[model samples]
Target: MTPTRARYDAVADFYASGWPDAIDDPASLRLLTLLEPIAGRRILDLACGHGRITRELARRGAAQVVGVDLSAALLERARAAERDNPLGIHYIHADVTTWSTPDQYDAVTCNFGLSDIDDLDAALATAARALRPGGLFVCSLLHPCFPGGPNVSGSWPSGGRYHDEGWWQATGELSSLRRQVGANHRTLATYLNAIRRQGLWLDELSEPEPSRDWASGRPDAARFPVFLVMRWVKATAQP
Candidate 1:
């Protein structure tokens, strides 16, 4: 198994348990806002841990929603949810980097999953390929400019802010799960360039604030943006 898969498998339970509450997260809320009027559209949800967003899309009237992730353990939770709720969302156990399909979708979404991908270029390319011309690709990520450090302090060790790449092991409160499931860091330029290389045009960008109810008592969240949401469109001209 790939290191990323193993890491997620190790903490799949924790991740799935916490995902229900993640809708209150600033990024997730923004993504939902951007996905408005999704009825009758087909959506491909990348790195869809436990089908939280996938089920939401299905509930919102998506004609079809396919969620893809690398970890079988996480997929198991997703499948269980599907069985109980029956949203008609399909779950695929495969790495996003190499996964492809002849079936095109109306939109592809990746919620806070880009940073977790080691081969972002490959993943972006695949996302582009999976979409019909003029289709949309929406994704959210930890803002590279101000990736908040450990905890909600929004503070980092000297020079830590500029780290372009490395493994970020979780520490403190939920260190056990965080340590097992680490993330990679990519520069903002890297992400933009990857989209450009895939012939995708930036349609929208947002630095969303956490919901008031969710940010309460979290001073740092109010002070800084924790996530960045972007929408890119597949251009008519192939890159």
Candidate 2:
């Protein structure tokens, strides 16, 4: 198994149980709001942990939804949810960086997963190939410019270089509920360039804040962007 898969497998249940609260967070709410009118669209959800957004898409009227992830343990949780709720959502055990299907989807989404993928280019290419011409790709990620690291100051430490790749462990009050995971930190230009290389066109970008209740406690978070949401569309014809 890939190291990322193993790491997620180790914390699958914990991650799933705690992440659901994020569904109500502003970034998530904005993503769902942006999806708008999914009555008959087919969606491919990448790195879909526990199928929270996958099941939500199906519930919101997506004609068909398929979720792919590297961790079988997480997919198992997703499957259990499907069994009980019956959203007709299909869960696949696969690596997002290399997985492909004979079929294409109307839309592809990855919620807070891009930064976690080791092979960003391959993953973008896979998403582009998985979409029909003119289909949409939407994703959210930890903001590259201000990714929270060891410091709680809400600022990149003065004179400290932003490392592009590393293993990060969560600590303090939330330590038990989180895991030390591998992550890639790319600049805004790197992400935009990757999307362009995959033949996807940028359509929208959003930096959403946490909800009032959550932000109230961490006021410093409001000063700098925490997450980034982007919407891209494939071209009708390759150049």
Residues 1-239, candidate 1: write the lDDT tens digits.
34254468878877887678346677887887887779999999999988889988998899999999988898899899889879899998888898888999999999988877888889998899999998999998767665343354221222466544655754434224445666676677878998888988999999987677646755554566667899888887655
- Give the TM-score of each candidate: 0.88, 0.88
Clashing pairs in 2: none
Local accuracy by lDDT, each model: 0.78, 0.77
Clash pairs, model 1 backbone = none
Backbone clash count, each prediction separately: 0, 0
Q: How close is candidate 2 to the true structure, as a TM-score?
A: 0.88
Q: Over the stretch 179-234, how does candidate 2's per-residue lDDT look in tens digits?
A: 35645556788889999899999989998886777556556555678778888999
Models, CA RMSD each: 2.7, 2.9
Q: What is the lDDT of residue 82 in candidate 1?
A: 87
